[model samples]
Target: MTDMNNPDNGGHGEWPQQQRPQYPRQPQYPQQPQAPQGYPQHAQYPPRQPGQQQPPYGYPVDDAAATTVLPPVPAFDDADATTLLPPVPPLGDAETTALLPPVVPGAVPGAPPAAPRHRQPVQPPFQQPAQQPVQPVGHPQGYPQAPLPEGQPEGRPRARARHAAPAPQPAEVFDPPTMTLKRPPAPGPAGPVGAPPVPPFAAVPAQPAPPAPPAAPRGRTGSPIIEPGLQPALITAGAAALLAGGAALGQVALALVVALLQLLTAAGWFRLNGMWPARQGILLAALAGFTADAAVLLADSDGGVAAVVGTLGGFFLLVLVLQTFRPSDPKERFYALTVLGSATVVTALCTTLLVADWVPAGVGAVALATVLAAAPLPGPKQLGPVLGLVAAVALGLLVGAPVALGALAGLGALVGRRVAAYDWPSRFVHMTAGVALPLAVAAPLIWMATDLLA
Candidate 1:
């Protein structure tokens, strides 16, 4: 195909065409052109494909295929203009030979004439001057310098000088005199012999002092405590007693146990649940006592009296607890009421289930809902009706239904006096009713168990 980028093809060629002198085509020959001597035509070749050996001529057969030319190319100096030109690869050996001067196979232009190399002049070997015989100087009498060889360097050959370093003048010794000497000698026939003339140059070579003795080790003496597991053993023993049903003795025993538990929890023996574990202890003890009393009642018909005594003691204890510790704050009041009331309700329900065979299971649910709904009524003045309702419920659980109704009416009349203020006396009615309610229910079961047991 014709190259369109050519500028030498005249206007007919889409560029300025070079003035032409067309020549006849050369005849094809079988022989290849020869290269000059001592110069390689093509020895370096790129890596070949596997299983394909290189041509002996060091180039691909496609060299002849790249010979097509359209026209003289337009020269471009700028990189942007060069984009219009067709690409050309670097020259091969044959192409490179065409660009250089024709080689002449003859002698080199700058070779020197051949001859044998000249030898350097030699000098005689180094010789030392004769050494005069050495005389011993500053050496001790018996020692002498050894004879030197002819080529050896001269020096005052070292005599073995002992480097004794003056025996490091022993550190100055200061010995104090324990006693003084008498100044005058006794007078004799020679008149004391001139006081035993002292020496003019006496040297008292200083002597080293004795080293100090090492100190004795200090002694430690005290009575050692041998107890390893004492605390844990004590705790285990106490825990055994607590878990062994000692709570049934009386309220005093119950109170002490509960108090000990609170103190231990406070002291971090166990985690403290809250300000007081009274509520939890009360509930636990109540459930335990109720369960025991119920089991006894079921097993022995005559065990009512013991149950009654125990139940009365426990219920009275819970009442005394509630009354003695008045609420110190609003939250304390709320919590006290919630805990005490819930425990009392649980105890009451347990007693009801044990004693009253006629109570439907739905009674507990109905009773709980009524108590919760009634507790939050508006003013203290209205507490009379609340107390009356509470007394009614209490009497209903203990006495019969008719007497309970009478008690509710009676409570309303009693609490109606001095209702607006914080009436401690009036509040007592509600408190005492709440206290009496649970015990009234429990006392019967206890009495029944006692009678059977007796």
Candidate 2:
């Protein structure tokens, strides 16, 4: 008997090659006889008893008087195996989201799938590949590199490079989250690219020193004591003196003009004293008339110049002595003594010479020139003095003074001009200079020349 559980029939697992299926499609055996209960399902046909005869291997079996009609088997051929498989059925409608069934391997289970089939890597439900975290993209140098997350493959060089360095951020100045870019140096040879240079500092120029302050007022350290309308009152007195003296004195109105000039001098001094009380003494001018009359008398005598010089020195010394003894506070005694004393002496000398006809018929020229010298004309300040000198020269020549003498006298105003420009104790510090200098210097020379000519 042949046993199914023994796999080969009659103890043979496979038939010899010539005795195997002769066609391309191997025929499936008819349903095998199943053993009873749990004996075995697949089994070969039961053994024949006694001396039964075996059928030949290639012969076909047919049973006479069979009830069922069977489909005829096609004759076997030995060409390509295309006709071996059953025809494929038409595809039916299916949902798009449905997952396709995995293709089961036939004989060779260990081999890779064929080209037309998919072969996904099998992994356990618990061990699914870890999803990578997203990273920001940036320049390679901009950000620092960190270790990659777990489970990522080593092949992603580009991803690693991108993740290693994040994008650059804008720098802030006032906030100072990062250092701001240094400012570019000024355009110069001192600085070069990549290396910054120190900048040069400019020197601020020094301002000029301020001018000295004007003279301070004096007299009890209180308000200035000038009377209201003093200038007008003095001018009216002077005009009256002129009219009265003109009638009383004889010849060419000498007393009238002298009185008027003296009154003018007093008024000028009074105004100046009020302007700067600390520096001038109006009292000295009251004594001027007395000295002036005596000087005129001495000039008519032989030794007049010595007498004049002595009188002037004595008056100057007396002023200094008075300053030492009286001791007035808030008063600039040095300035008062020097300016007042010099001015009074100079005024006396000028008046005496004017009254005494010392210049030999040149009074009109001298007087006009002196007035012009002090006049406030426009253009250069020097223009006033220069025009005055030229006028003196021309007028003196016309008035019978010699050209040499007139020219010498005209140059005298140059000294006066220098004094006029000085910053003096008072505005009238130049009173002596502007009024007395030209006449005092020129008159003496004119007198000598006239005497020599005579």
Candidate 3:
């Protein structure tokens, strides 16, 4: 092969330029001949003459124009040019110029000029009349008058009065009469001098002492040891325990119970946070709980915990995204996120019982704790929680659950009871959230305990 890289090679030489192809020009056609000269021609107008006028071509010649005569055009001259325009009036002082009306151009030569505008005489500013002084009407004759204050005029009195004080009067002295005491003889069963004789002293009748003031009705010294709504709370706790115990029957039945519990939790949480009428937030939290439950159920036994965690994380992100679309103030949005996040977490916690095998033991401990705490035992306020924990441990022993699990569940129950009592919870809150929250709160503890002990 020839050296392809060499500039001297024939392949590297410049190639000839290609010429552009041309086509033949179009053929020309012959022009037609002009019309014959014999055709009739249009009539021509005559040329205009100096100092002469003519009507325009195509203008009709009426009898008026033909019969009437027009004056001949004047010859151009300096004198005649000066007379063409009217004379201009000389400028005057500003006052006269302003008073005169403007001269309008193109007015009739002899027509009267517009009447001149005259200046109106100015009037002086208004002056208020001097006010006359009012005379005093009720002056007593020879009465001394108060001296006028400086700057006040002689005839005019001050707007305010300063009255002269009245003269002092003479005082009179008073004398009292004197009295003398007379001596009486030594005491005999008789009256003193100039008095009637007295009778012997008689025994006085005894009078009953006033009945003692009705004893002040005693009021309660302190708050009750057990908070109000304990009975309803106890009943609610019992119901939650019964539902949790249903796990032995079937997972579906237990799941249905848990779902109901989560629904109540969502609703109660919104109301507790004063966010009622927030139907969307309630439904979203409930859905998150249901999803977590379903995920726990569908997942393998060992993957149950992982399934719940994943579902919770996904719904958390969903809550964040949904919050962005809410048409609320920034503060309201933040508050909603706080309420919604807490509600979702609380609802999701219910899934722990479903995954854990010791659901009955834990729920039983919680119920027992609530029952003992609600009982009106005679003791200090702290006695309730102590007794509740004791009962829980004993119940756990009987049920063969760990003592730690029992104590934890009982503690959770006490805490949930306190929450129910907080902010003066109503009977409705006690029945719903109060009933379910103990078991819900203890579920995770139970799960962890069971896992550790196993």
Q: Which of the numbered candidates is closest to the native, going by highest lDDT? A: 3
Model 3 alpha-carbon drift over 4 Å, by segment:
1-228
Residue-wise C-alpha lDDT for candidate 3, range 1-454, written one tens digit per residue = 4444444332322333353233355599785465679975433334434434344344677665454454457688765666655543222232233444333222333469856545444443333343343343433353334465788865543342432212121122221221211222222333343353232346467789989999988975654333535676567565656666678787888899889888988887777667878898889989999999999889998999999999899999999888888898999999999999988998998888888867888888888888778777897967887998998888778988876888888888888777656665656666666776776777788888778765
Per-model TM against the reference: 0.20, 0.36, 0.50
Better lDDT candidate (1, 2): 2
> What are the per-residue Cα lDDT tens digits for candidate 2 across 1-454?
3443543243333556567544344588786565789674542345654344434455565463132244457776633443565433222122111234222212233457645424445433232243343343332452334444687743332332222322222221221222222232322333343344332435557789999898787545443322212233233233333433443554236533543445444444434444345333555653664465466554655555555566667777777787777666536666566566655654555444433332444444554455565566788857866786788678767776666555555565345334433433243534423343444445445544444443
lDDT over C-alpha atoms for residue 104 of model 1: 27
Tell me the spans in candidate 2 whose CA falls farther than 4 Å from its real position: 1-256, 259-263, 266-280, 298-300, 328-331, 354-360, 370-384, 402-405, 412-454
Cα shift from native, residue 9, model 3 (Å): 99
Candidate 3: lDDT over CA atoms? Answer: 0.69
Residue 15, candidate 2: alpha-carbon lDDT: 55
The 10-residue segment with the lowest total lDDT in model 2:
89-98
Q: How much does candidate 1 score in TM-score? A: 0.20
Please state the error at residue 118 of candidate 3 in Å: 66
Task: Give a tens-digit lDDT track for model 1, residues 315-428.
Answer: 646655764577578676656555554444334333322332212211221233223323445667356345544554563455343333333323322221112111222232
Cα lDDT listed for each candidate: 0.36, 0.46, 0.69
Shift of residue 312 alpha carbon in model 3, Å: 0.6
